[model samples]
Target: MNDLHQKELLLKSILENTRAQTQAIEDDELELLETLITRREGIIRQVDKLDQEMARTTPGTSKEPTGPIKELLRQIITIDDANQELMEKSVQDMGKEVEAVKEELRTIRERRRQGESYVPEYGDYREEGVFFDTRE
Candidate 1:
């Protein structure tokens, strides 16, 4: 088989394995992202090989690849781009969640500034010592 065909086959196989990995994700989204990146790297390697063979075999044949191979490569590029955007958004969302929790804690502290307080499990909160007289 020609190098171009071989590279295409390898890329297809990698894509299939990647899809399987993605489908296996239940709760850990990072696993899917990691597998996507790995698949992208494999696609890049395969495309590089295909490009080299095409250049060596048929010099000055159209720079743009045609047919199914071209479509598959385009899809791979799009997926990688999308994955990067999603990863960035996920991090930003997590930062926002943390900030929201901090805001809530700050509000609670401000409201309870004058009452008997207990130290937080995760941090220090000043305790107000007010002795109660129980003699009637």
Candidate 2:
């Protein structure tokens, strides 16, 4: 029972941290995002271990979670969903930006190719006659 409560508090803290990390993702802070993701993964591992322990302790019947636990779970779910949406949007925006850059590079390359093949308007030079051979 006490262990369960402690685990619940830990879970809540992890959820809050995860939520903050998700917000960091939206801000485009990739370094902080990476650190936060690693921390969240560790917390997830802890949560999984606690869940397994709880399952082992209760074998006959499943116990209903407390009201606060339920609420916390709901909040975590909502935040995770929003985070997923933001991540998807960010990926799409990056893809579009990459394509635009590629197109610009192609255009620049084409212009350079054209410039290399350009011919100036000066007339061609040629020798037509020789005048000094008669004196020899």
Candidate 3:
């Protein structure tokens, strides 16, 4: 296929992958998210190769890529930006959750230690004495 067609296809593929990546993150599908990211990287590489080939073939041409290619690129960037925002929020939220869990664990451990303090070191409880008062 021609370079333009190839680039278009690659861009479209990236767009599709980006959308899927967003979905994967939202769904909490780690494996699928990784796969989508890898696929998108490969598509990006292909696009880069096409750009290099084109530049070599047309040394003095300074015209920018236009039409559907431009539009595709714009859409890709917008979606990617949103995806990045989502990922940042996810990471932040995850950190908060981890902190909360850690705090809970600390609280539990502290309570356990405090509770243990109430017990005898020998692990046995004996009455020191019994006191009874009877009045008639």
Query: Among these predicted structures, which one has the highest TM-score?
Result: 3
As a whole number from 0 to 100, the lDDT of residue 69 in candidate 2 is 77
For model 1 the local lDDT of residue 105 reads 97
Q: Write the per-residue lDDT of candidate 3 for residues 27-126, one digit (tens) a residue.
A: 8788999999988888888888889899999888665879999999999999999999989989999999999999999999999999999989988877
Candidate no. 3 TM-score? 0.86
Q: Count clashing pairs, candidate 1.
A: 0
Candidate 1 — which residues are off by over 4 angstroms?
13-28, 111-113, 116-136
Task: Give each prediction's root-mean-square deviation over alpha carbons.
Answer: 8.5, 4.2, 6.0
Candidate 3 segments exceeding 4 Å error = 125-136
- lDDT accuracy of residue 10 in candidate 3: 88
- Higher-scoring candidate on TM-score, 2 or 3: 3
lDDT by residue for model 1 (15-64), tens: 56555544444234766657766776777777787778778898988777
- Candidate 2 colliding pairs: none
lDDT of 2 by residue, 2-79 (tens): 657877887788788877878798789988888888887888788778878878877764566667777888888888
1 against 3, candidate with superior lDDT: 3
